[model samples]
Target: MSAADVWPIVKARLELLDDARKPLIETYIAEIEHRMKHYCNIRALPDNLLYVWASMTVDAVRVDLPNADEIADTVGGGANIKVGDTSVSGGSSGSGVTNTSKAVIDQVVLDYRVDLNRYRQMRWGG
Candidate 1:
């Protein structure tokens, strides 16, 4: 199915202004299509799964949006946040670091019962 076919679901999942998010949504749809293009053995998934994947992609990208402008300045440092006289500071360095967005997306895929291996292309006879 085309991006237009699944746009309503994507929009509802995002819950944002259509004008503000349409470009990003299109980008994600394009990325998904491009990734699947070379995988010859990929199974034909249901439309719901495709919609979920698209929504997940949007969510993954959204997680990074908050830091985009800050990162573009080439200035890196800890974040100092204060709320109601309470202060908190943290940096992007240290151990036990995990990509929370990816983890969450992975969990969502599992919740949806997606078989990720189906997207892989098999090869035989080297």
Candidate 2:
């Protein structure tokens, strides 16, 4: 699909206006990794994830199965456990974690589910 086919349509709908286009990458899938930096805490990875984030656009796309052999080959098919309880209050927040210590993560999770359902609908021609 073309870039113009996807980019401009969603730009007008989103409210907050922060860019949301995730790059089609090969390094590893990006997850919000929070960490402590110099004096203040930073909620990001200390690597090339940010650079990969910008050179893309806010367009939804899909691809085939991953040839990923990283975790499955390295550790006998175990997945990493992400901490924090998914609570009634959404993700959780206190002092020095993520801005996601609030309701944003919760909403994002809900949005993800909705998107997944839409994908299923599109796949099945429903």
Candidate 3:
């Protein structure tokens, strides 16, 4: 699969990864980048693309991926974002959001999805 196509799923997986284990996720990426050309016959993307893909992955998984700390900064003080359910409030720190906020956010949902075809086109240029 093209790197672009795989980015969405990778982001989702990384989001689910434990906060402490996120660093290791970078390791997986280096190898994936290397193999995208050799193993998967994908065109080699510039390092910028790799970074962009990684960033996109983190976002898809519903987490902040600021360059300030890479994976370390990913897990912020805010409540964890569940795949299908997400809530936002002024205060990230609180008792699981106020009853009123909960009611409002209950209607908010983020469905995780990945499109591999996009990656294929970007990688194979077909």
- The number of the candidate with the highest lDDT is 1
TM-scores, all models, native as reference: 0.46, 0.18, 0.29
Tens-place lDDT per residue, model 1, 7-71, is 66666654544356577657766555444433334445445456556654554443333244322
Worst 10 contiguous positions by lDDT, candidate 3: 104-113
Kindly provide the TM-score of model 2 when superposed on the true structure, using C-alpha atoms. 0.18
Expressed as tens digits, the lDDT of each residue in 1-126 for candidate 3 is: 355455445656444443463444444454445533443344665453554445434443233222223333345544355323433322233324223322222222112113222343434555
Per-prediction CA RMSD (Å): 10.2, 18.7, 11.4
TM-score of 3: 0.29
Colliding residue pairs in candidate 2? 92-101, 93-101
Range of the 10 consecutive residues with the lowest summed lDDT in candidate 1: 66-75
**Order the candidates by lDDT, highest first — what do you get?**
1, 3, 2
Model 1, residue 110: what's the lDDT?
43
**Runs of candidate 3 exceeding 4 Å displacement:** 1-25, 31-41, 46-48, 56-73, 83-126
Candidate scoring better on TM-score of 1 and 2: 1
The models' CA-based lDDT, in order, is 0.46, 0.24, 0.39
Comparing 1 with 2 on lDDT, the higher-scoring candidate is: 1
Displacement of residue 80 (Cα, Å) in model 3 is: 1.7
